[model samples]
Target: MAKQYVRKKEEVLQTTVTSIRHNEYYNMQKMFDELYEKSSKNESFESLMPIILSKENILLAYRNIKTNGGSITPGTDKISIKDLKSLSSEEIIENVRHIVTGKRGYNPRAVRRKDIPKPNGETRPLGIPCMWDRLIQQCIKQVMEPICEAKFSNHSYGFRPGRSTENAIAELEKYNVYSNLHYVIEFDIKGFFDNVDHKKLIKQIWALGIHDKQLIYVIKQILSAPIMLPNGEKIRPLKGTPQGGIISPLLANIVLNELDHWIESQWENNPVAYKYSVRMNKNGSENKGSGYRAMKKTKLKEMYIVRYADDFRIVCRNKKDSVNIKIAVTKWLKDRLNLDISEEKTKIVNIEKQYCDFLGFKIGLKHKRGKFVTESHVADKNLARETEKLKKQIKRIAHPADDKDAATQTYRYNSMVMGMQNYYQHASHVNKDFAIVAWKINDLLLHELKPSRQKGRLARKGRELTPMEKERYGKSKTIRYDSMTGIPIYPIGYVQTKAPSNFKRGKTPYTEEGRKMMHKDLSINTTLMHELMKQTVHGSIEYADNRISLFSAQHGKCAITGVEFRDVNEIHCHHKIPKSQGGTDEYQNLMLVLNEVHILLHATSNETIQKYSELLQLDPKQKVKLNKYRKLIGLETI
Candidate 1:
């Protein structure tokens, strides 16, 4: 049912798992801040090359690209980060410089084309950028991110740092719950990533003062790069950036930001959101945006929009405004971005009888406390699909194995369940949904572990129990594993209200500490990290086993940096070809490296190498080895 819901989005299958993810600049945060300040006040920039090509900026850019997903995905040249680890730091940095500076030419290689199955049984195309192109894209992205952040809508959540689907949902709630909005205009621009107009996007970028000719030349080339399909057929794009490129989302946002601004001008900005806003105090309430009498006299109807990537929703207090805004938005996108809002998915519905799906949430109006409140539930279709996926995963991994293998299986099982929990931690019914799923998984695990079909008490008992179990469950039992190794079904008892988010949303990322906050924000789902360890999404025991063996083989030293890893999280099992960009997970593919060193090995950024060398007090020889691995994994060597 979930997959079947969006029936008309055919062209999107040609892009990567691209719609889903964003934020930040580091070290050069202040420099970017200055750009943001200038841009916020509507000024143009020239001669940004020094900062963009500066050793530090390039290093930080690589840092972001390497640590984030996609460092491993190959481009037209069929080169990925794995191929770049041998480059010395100077060689890598010089490579990025040459690409952007036109020393080696700014032309990007063709995208290595691929497709992955979407939940809807449709395949999504992945235009994977080469390591070199990816690095340069990030280099450009880092410079442009802060400037763009200065101008992006608070309502725009896609690809920006700190903003998320939940945040977008919360904004929807503000209009639906706090206000009297009743009608929903829900729609997504079909094939938005694939259809972005190159000329218009560049004009928008220049408008933002990102007018560096060389930089502009590089981006134009990236945009113009061809998509190489599986049969080696190349499709040169006249519009739109590749879905997997680091800059694709930013470009899409920039292109659609025009849509954001136009709509805001009509409703949010032209009159300003507060043109008809309200507020209250402890003792009294006030219509601060306007007096009650003026609000009554005014002919304005309030409209609010919340957007994440290509998908967006416009809410209004009446059908007339909703319909009008929808019509206006349709025209705006066609006229501005030259994209079409999907008629199948885009509908204006009353809150009482119908609802719209956004970011895996079922959003509609709920009558609460004698009033209708805009509320979201974990969509039934999503729960059903996720539970099905969980059941299938359990079928594969929930074996009745003996000894440490049981412990390992238990760890694998918990990771899957926990990942699901974390992915929905921001849900209003996280507790309830997790309970239902966990119970089913628990029952299924017990069934799989039993040597034979056991009835009644035996079935419930679940193998021989230890003293800790008896104390916990008395006569009845839950699934059991090695005494020291595994856990029962993880409890889903915590309430995850949409409490105030500490994240500053669009304002974070390119700011100094925002990158850390962005990483923290994005880390709500660590399961993806493990799932990303391989292409087919295997259980991580093999990966884990390799990490243990490699650590012992090296006596716990990082393979590249040869430094001691103090933290467990720092112990990364890197695929010599990283799974982040789609590497396979065989024993031969494994490498034990500390997280920081892992960055260098799969690196796009150079800050850590510089910082680590100073902190660990490495000699020239050791430092060279570190930089050798620092060869920005995205471009030269890749």
Candidate 2:
């Protein structure tokens, strides 16, 4: 257990923390915004060296990397954030600056590779970069992002600064309610990130008005960095951005942006296919004098797309258009980017007849109260997976004599349930579906948590009740063990539903102020009370998470006097088992109580106890629990 941990509830609820920047960095951002604004308005640039190599920008990148959570993982260099922390600020800035300025010829090391378990029980590879290299990449990403963002299509929403899965999902559902477009074309690119053509990507960067020769050479170098696999084998890839690199998402988006533009042209701009409908000039923009904008002011678009990374869905007004557009897109991807679409995975479905899966939500039509409407719900696969997962966890507790007690198991189980509910709270029938899941899962809980009644059950438990003996408990859903611990278990459907958020309208990403408005998170919708309610935090708990966990364990009261904590400043974490006596960092050894109580517990003289006399006054129950806690730590009770 840690000595202490604390944080404001408000901080955890925010969608994102504002990037901490120095005063000088603010001016640099303004300059970057101005340059990016020019490129967005059809300007060209031959040099970005002045901005990229500036000392202020260099320092800012270093600061941001230090703040970033991923900086801890080491690359092939075997230097982590811990090593960087050992150096002075000036020393680190100089080291990063030398590499960026070509003073040391900028040799990038291979990425450290590891695999993580997926939700569906599969594994995916991840690349970890050293802090030094991440600093250089961050320098380029911060500047390049604003410039690319201006020219990037509004429909391409992956890895963008202000965009998220929620925005993309909302856009997908918008066409459902606003238009008669019921046909959907879903396509998966065959190894999108792994097969991205380096030549084609470079051309796209040039097309975006960034033509810095030196910078381009450096980016190419980064793309060619070798991969150090788990088995001590190193492989150099000719194509594909490694999944875990800092700039991989931006690089992938640049490759996909080309696809976004070509699709937009065929759907809205190019007149060869829609000559009978509208007239257009050579450039993709509409001809204002030709009444092109006015003619279709009230008309719904026949085709459009919403893309996140490699996943995309094309919606059309009719099945004929859907099939044609799908063919056109397949040909276009091969010709323009030299990539192939997965024929086996791709399909065109009439959404009105059957639903399509996108971003974990089922998008299709629903007949409700005499009207047919489009709505998204949790996929059946996810519900089945979660149900089976709970059953397995309950079985471990019931049959096996594991190290974990009933109280610890109950807290962890509840935490897992709360996290799942938080993710799917936006689904339309989530409450209804989860109620069914809860009904099934709670039975498993009741079976394990309740003491056994059979003859064999008593011997297995070491001490238990018989069939003739009786016991009292709360509602069937609530699991309990004793006066303390074994918290009530709630299920997925417990959380209230939250509506999806609409994107910032009429604001372009080119300007500094416009980007500011787009980045604002005014909604305070996340509820973390259940996250805090867990009596024990599993695995290695973060400092903030430990504070929240112990706060729940205390029930927000001073353990000695049983008084509610009026302010967070008064709360303190006490060690139940002293470190000198061989207590480790495991969370079970710590307790949250009042500052006065913690000081009195460590008091060596009678005068010290008398100094905190008011706080020492406890009722019979508090005195008993206090003495119990004291005995564990080898101390005498006041």
Candidate 3:
């Protein structure tokens, strides 16, 4: 009243309850019925939803308007036909516009939805698509299909759409096409999950006409789903975002199937349709020049899909096929699904002779040679020299404490031998390089024993030598016995040492009380000597008389011929019946004779001895001659 006496009427915008009410329930019921029918036909859940929602624009618009708000006002007021006819066209248009703009009622407020916060405190709403990832996935899926078809048949192993890219690359190289292809195109889908067009995906699935409970579950997940984190944070994954999730593999598989189908369709009408038939040529030796001879036509049927999670590798017969496949896939994604491709990361290369790295493996052709060639540089020369020096040092020591210590010191040597053997075995089934040379030093020392003094005519009295001289002489004569054997020994080059003997005697040098003080000192010397002796006399014989080689034919006259040839210094014992002729070394077989005569008698035939010596050489006849000789020499014989 203070500003003006008259004021223009204010218009208010308002919404009736009926305007907010939706036919969503009815539409959803219809969809459910269709899905049920599809399910009855055994269609998959992913292939059922799109058909039901194809004409439900009203429902979608309602959802969008509810969440984003709009200016449409709802009312039941009626206008008379006479009033409408009285109004001009401009007035009617203005009135209709006002109604549509909601100028006559209270405006409704937009619904506010809570956003999930990331680790960095950034908030994001669910159901957004990532533009970059979609492009990459499309690109990869397009590139791989033709190559797979060419390399493998429908019945081949790993023919699924989700086959490993590495395997696909290898199969291509096996066909000898990878090297000719120089440029490689790689594709990656950026933010695939965040950018997914759920509606489009549903349409695609529905177009397939499959229906199942799984589809319902997927739909529920697509709407109002929550992802729980270890840190107690909850998030809702966006529709097209590709990331870690239980449903990721399934979704990725779905995408791959679509891409595979698209690629196959494109190839059906292409100029390279003939090339697809060449897969049959994979059989026979004639295909060797093309690298397909080893591959069986039957076996080639199974290599279609190559998938490693979200990454894809599409195989094609030629570069043109690869590029065309990419273009077709890109068009399908962009025109049908509103997705984009990332060209920067997409590359095409020839992987025929070399390996194509995928999922941490370098996969390439399976050559007839089938050998792996590495491109790493040889080991440093300094390191090799150092290793060789260490090997020499290890070779010098014969015995080590344990195998572990020995292995540590001689690692290079052992590795060399084993590696050579392994290499040969791999190359030719023979292990000729496994030879090892073992060496040991055997030091043999010799010593001689000299009598302390001379006897009889050879005796030298006062000249027996003093203690000091004796000590000097003993030391001079004290040849160091073999370190191995107690007897005088000599080294004969390098020989393996014998295992130490078990003396079997419990001998201790120290007294019970003194044991504690001298135990170690006394035991060491004895143990060392025992060990040396054990090693030295390991094969030699021992006797009490110390007269080694007691039996000798050197003395011409035998002991039995002593009395008969008393003046003769040479003598030998004779056997009436030679030992070789069943004779024994008993008194009856004993006879004395000159060395020459004994030899002569032995040289005579056994028949001669039996006929002549047996009678003429009888004990009494031999005793009479022996007595005459003995009397002349002042000796008695019997």
Better of 2 and 3 by lDDT: 2
**Cα-based RMSD of the predictions, in order?**
9.5, 11.3, 43.9
Please give the clash total of every predicted structure, in order: 21, 1, 74
Model 2: lDDT to the true structure: 0.64
| Model 3 stretches with alpha carbons more than 4 Å out | 1-172, 175-184, 213-218, 222-224, 228-235, 241-244, 268-305, 316-328, 352-355, 363-638
In Å, residue 471's CA in model 1 sits off its true spot by 18
* Top candidate by lDDT: 2
lDDT of 1: 0.61
List the candidate numbers ranked by TM-score, top first: 1, 2, 3
RMSD over all Cα atoms, model 3:
43.9
Q: Locate the minimum summed-lDDT window of 10 residues in model 1.
A: 8-17
Question: Considering TM-score, which of the candidate structures 1 and 2 is the better prediction for this target?
Answer: 1
| lDDT (CA) per prediction | 0.61, 0.64, 0.32
Question: Residue pairs in steric clash, candidate 2?
Answer: 1-585
Give the TM-score of each candidate: 0.74, 0.71, 0.29
Better of 1 and 3 by lDDT: 1
